[model samples]
Target: MLTYCLNEYPSAHGFENGLRPQLTFICKAEGNEAAIPRVMHKHDERFELMFILAGTGIYNIDGRGYNVKRGDLLLFNAGVLHDENPHTSDDLLIFSCGVEQLKFEGLPLNYLTTRSQAAVMPSGHLYGEIRGIFEQIWQQVMSKKRYGAEIAHHLLSVLLLLCRNIWLENNPEYSSADSLLGQKIKTYIDNHYKDEIALKSITAALNMNQFYLAHVFKAWSGYSPKQYQTRRRIGEAQSLLLSTDLGVTEVANAVGYDNVNNFHRIFHNLVGIPPARYKKFWLTGHIKS
Candidate 1:
């Protein structure tokens, strides 16, 4: 009898440590003759690293298609849209490991954000080492041995480190400061939207030139620092309006707009309505005529 383990597989919620990074591995055992359909899926805030140990398939990621074969390693970032379709009748043995809570670690955030899937080619000595590690992980899963989760996590970490080395070696011009700095800035703005945050304060904290930082940050992040900050603040205000009993003025102030009139104007300019009416529309899901 061919057994399949999908939803019944164990969850990795208990693997979180208080300080270090956490890795999760989920395995599936599907029959070789199964016809897997194509579907679109996205992860909310976690990155996925997938390896195809056996079988032939085609994967569509970020609107680009890749012809995948055995011994192919793929990396995908958070919020990316991807799908998989098996082209052959052979049951696909796949390993999908998710890495969460990633720190800067001297790598650019753009490395994670860019939605390009490159196959890790094994050419030199590093190729064999990488392939061996993946094979060991695959074997552990197939054997259903004790402590497989722990073993898989350790292997996954080594895989990530190897990939990082390859990326740095290939792209010499990439900068952790230029790529990761903006993400740090955005994260800070998201958390502190309710407080008083200024360009000067941010530049000082980040130790970057004010004008140059703003230009490069906007160029890379697709939003000016101030614009991104305002958007986040308004988004928070909108959420509060719909979910809480807070008044318009309270919501505006809570999102860092001290002047109610200024908040009304900005809210109207962006949302096409004043704060009060916007809140009502959101609550009722009604469009004003």
Candidate 2:
């Protein structure tokens, strides 16, 4: 029998601390020329971050392909399906971790993933700075120092804040869109999907006809307004189910569903399994492609 451990970097000292970032260790991975994408895997609501110290690869994440290389950081939020296939010549080495919850400046972390933060970041001084933070985290974990977890958690938070700000500066919304109308509709949905939102209200606010709005949104998203909203709700529910100890009813209500049964039905239809089973798969490490 082979036993694995998330204690690879934990210090050799007995430390006791309660308050810290909700970070979970999945594994620290290194890839080489033989690395090939096998299957897309996900954890219901766990966010995975990879600090690419060395690599040249193409990452297929959530239906998009991103060309990545050394000094790049990749973030996979919640339940996104992702695959990483590196170039035959370039070796890939990374530090990966799972986070159940993270925050910066009172803003939510989900916005980073939704805005396509999975793409490879450009390399430069900031890259080195961020990489240094990753190294510090590794050092603290390996140092066997006092308050090792606390130091690592604080470093990780700073790294996240830097990454989020850089991404925001680099990728400006509403600047580049297939269609302005589509962009507007998407923005509205992304911002208010968790609320008691309606297409009628959106159309009225944008001063656009409901039919035209629906048509353009569908053309861009391949999902109707209601369908897209349902998808968003389910996605949030999955995140909550995995990250928190919330019951099915609580999860449903948190995602804005008044009827728990309806939420379960819709979740099963989209996920091809019941909500409870889906949560169980992640909890038991039985996730699939």
Candidate 3:
């Protein structure tokens, strides 16, 4: 077989809006009991792409639950809070990569797609191809050979382009007005989750009536304002537990729960496990069924 010259192949267009992706990290959890359940968390400056290599699981993304299985690719856009707590008996295995400085045309910085799009998409016919690409990137990064970073960077660009193509294929549609209002409500909650704010006061501050505010918000997002606030509080608590060495009571207080017992009850209700045990499983990497 003769080697073909670059001019012999078809021409290709470059990325739109000068998009350049920087790979921050690659994480793989396979056949490990400690890897099933990850505490809820968010990345302000990076987006994450995770592929379920084997097993079925449920992931909480942006205050919603998504059932995922093999051949599923999950996208966690920048600033989108998410968590994973698979069943104890399932053999869940996943490979994840974090990308920074990514922005498609008309999208926010570090965001792969709009918030309205579904975060989990079936890889379909591309599953094997995409999985191979991820494995190549992982191998390149782990080898530490010459030009490893450069190779991995190019591979990451390929992965992102594929993801964008798939997202485009999905053809997600949502009203801009509703998305904006939902964002405003979410922003208010994010800024004031520490406070004991009520729906009436939230509506007053936003200058909208309770009924309209509630309707629009619930329509735009699956959760009500109250439910969203509670999840936000618990998500922060999860982060604090994994990142800090503070006691459960201190974590509760930090997340705005004055009563320690109340904190435990709410945390258990939302997380399906006690706060202290959540931290322990994360640390030990094994869940005690």
Candidate 4:
């Protein structure tokens, strides 16, 4: 996985020039896959969209499958499980790009994130046009010429906006709140999980039965409300660890963990390592991910 960077682009989240989370610039790209692989099971933190530049495959996203061919696009929202296997004995080439972390700005956040299937963007002629834009951006990133980063940033913006338009056009009935009640619960948790969140408080706030809330929330997202909240907290914690110099206890507290020990246990449980070690993994240049 490669993480692209543009230090002089406009940021969507008040990140000044040359910062992360700009209106979602390309954080990574996988250009050519001349050497074929039959099967791939992958997941990532970023919102990933893959344009099938060539070949055909059965693409699976979050358990739902779609038969995809050249000129098709497959979307895997941040952290969604996806797999691909081609029926033909040919190389499956793809141009995959991602945003390291999601901060909704120009794109429709809820619609993109809660997608249950690998969306198919079918436009054969338009595929060539989109690929041209990608090629220009790829050259800019690779060349690193004067204003290369800024130029690439603009090109990336165009690419994403075009893609978003295509995605929305392809699915006219796409709803940001696919599951209205469940989405509301998710939004509340995403915003308030940084503080104490009681399940009963959520139920009372929503004026719904606990069992019904659990059923819907679980159905919408695989996890129950509490589980989702914890996962969100941990996800925030990971972001903080990567982006800040705060200590483990402070990071834990920042993400709503009152007990440092419990936070440590949960972080380790969800992530394979402790907080300190996780940070070290980034610091040590072990991976560009």
Candidate 5:
């Protein structure tokens, strides 16, 4: 299986100018597959949107499994855990483009990360248009013509605008307190997980009382606000420990734990192992029965 580590375009290189929303097209041969070396990797500044033009595959995103086939589009937020592997013998053709320069007017970045699976499957001409754009972008990238990146970025921005419009049209109806509010709260926690974020702060941000936000968030996401926050922080910590060379203390800080002892205690309670051991296991990529 092919392994890829997506990182920021190095700053020192002149490639930074070309890095803005450049399309990367992959056409794998039969018998070729790919895997993410670990659940996560170094945090990059850009997001990725991928569409499968042909063939079938299995996508693994933060332990969730998805069946990918032709016409399937997938979005990944910066720092989210994700990987894809081909499942069929047919050659796999995929179009991937950066979202750094694209402005998705009505949709929040958190929406793409939290609701990516559902958003990709939404019915309507939106999906069709996105698929068509991907096809054209793939052709442009593969042709290696002059100004290909410029053309691809423009097409990708148009597709994103269409998607944002569809999302705005459906937002009110599809966004229940549970899904919408829960997603917003989750995003907040992800950004503030390392700090002592009070429930009051969370409720205030949502313009709701603590009681209502807590109850609704739990009902929708299957975890209380604090519980979900801790879980997410720990999950991110685990990913960093396993994937990056950052030290344990740095990983602890990365996830918002200032006290090393507290970090160890929580890591053990949630992961059932110490950070180092868990990292070792993650590196092995073993599927424990």
Candidate 6:
């Protein structure tokens, strides 16, 4: 047998001493027959990593859609908006965890990657290793045994390092000046999606011609400005429905809909189900649709 010693190989790159990640929660979802959406939202103080254990879906991250499949890992850095649109195939399984107080050297708070990097990456050859790590974490969390949190903490560090290595190997090269304007528009909308704003307001705030802004934004995001804002509002409405005890009208108004009828129409059109039934399906595991 051959053995290797760590002291024999000094690495030039290593994790910073200040790096400490706190695991907030770990969850696994499977066997959902309906492709219910987890709408556009972001965590301001934590990072979320998800492994698609099976099935395929579309994840909209930072205004673009990624077609993700099994063995794919998705990273949602803090304050980055994302929407989950699962396909209605009934075999989707996902393992996800949330981490707080995470900061990498030279990176923003809770960010594992730069803005240029794609949020979704295929595990490829590392599929087994990555999946095993998630499974271990899930077991620790579910068992609630002694030293479980400590064990999961160490495992999280290893998982993060593996993700960083994968990112380095991928060497993302997607950012450019052309995308900046589109991103700016998205940021503005994200900040004010609940407000009664218009295309003219966006153009005036960003100081771009109305026509030019529309053209560039459509080209970059595959949705017109109005379309993007509508989706954003509807997405938040969906979030409030399932996650909170707010009533339907209250939910509608909270998401910027003054008229509940209009809200119902729009929500039904986009989500393929009304708000009340959507919440009922999630709560009761039965959908009339």
Candidate 5 at 212: error in angstroms?
Answer: 7.1
Q: Whose lDDT is greatest here? A: 6
Deviation of model 2 at 146, angstroms:
2.5
Candidate 3 vs candidate 4, TM-score winner: 3
Stretches of candidate 3 exceeding 4 Å from the true structure: 1-20, 30-40, 54-69, 83-89, 103-108, 142-150, 176-181, 206-220, 287-289
TM-score, ranked from best to worst? 6, 3, 4, 2, 5, 1
Each prediction's TM-score against the native? 0.43, 0.50, 0.77, 0.56, 0.46, 0.86
Q: Can you write out model 4's per-residue Cα lDDT over 1-289, one digit (the tens) per residue?
A: 9876886665443212333332243433232323222122334546666677777766645534467887886777665544445443345456666654334444333225336323667755687888887778767877879998777667655665666666555565434443667667876776687778888989898888988888887765557788767766776777788888899999999889999999999887766567887777767834223
Q: Per-prediction RMSD in angstroms? A: 14.1, 11.9, 3.9, 11.2, 11.7, 2.7
- Model 5, global lDDT: 0.60
Lowest summed lDDT across 10 adjacent residues in model 1 is found at 12-21
Question: Relative to the true structure, how large is the alpha-carbon lDDT of every model?
Answer: 0.61, 0.66, 0.82, 0.63, 0.60, 0.86
lDDT (10s digit) by residue, model 6, range 55-144: 888787887668889999999999888888777666878888999877777788889988778889999999999999999999998889
Q: Which tens-of-lDDT digit does each residue in 18-88 have in candidate 3?
A: 76789999988876463435545699989999998887776867644577888999999898887676554
**lDDT of model 3 at residue 194?**
88
- How well does model 2 score by local distance difference test? 0.66
Worst 10 residues of 4 by lDDT: 31-40
lDDT of 5 by residue, 38-121 (tens): 222223555666666566765544323467777666666655645445554546566666566432334343234344334343
Better of 5 and 6 by TM-score: 6
Per-residue accuracy of model 1 over 207-230 as CA lDDT, tens digit each:
878898787667655567786666
Q: Which stretches of candidate 2 lie over 4 Å from their true place?
A: 1-20, 31-38, 88-90, 104-111, 115-118, 174-289
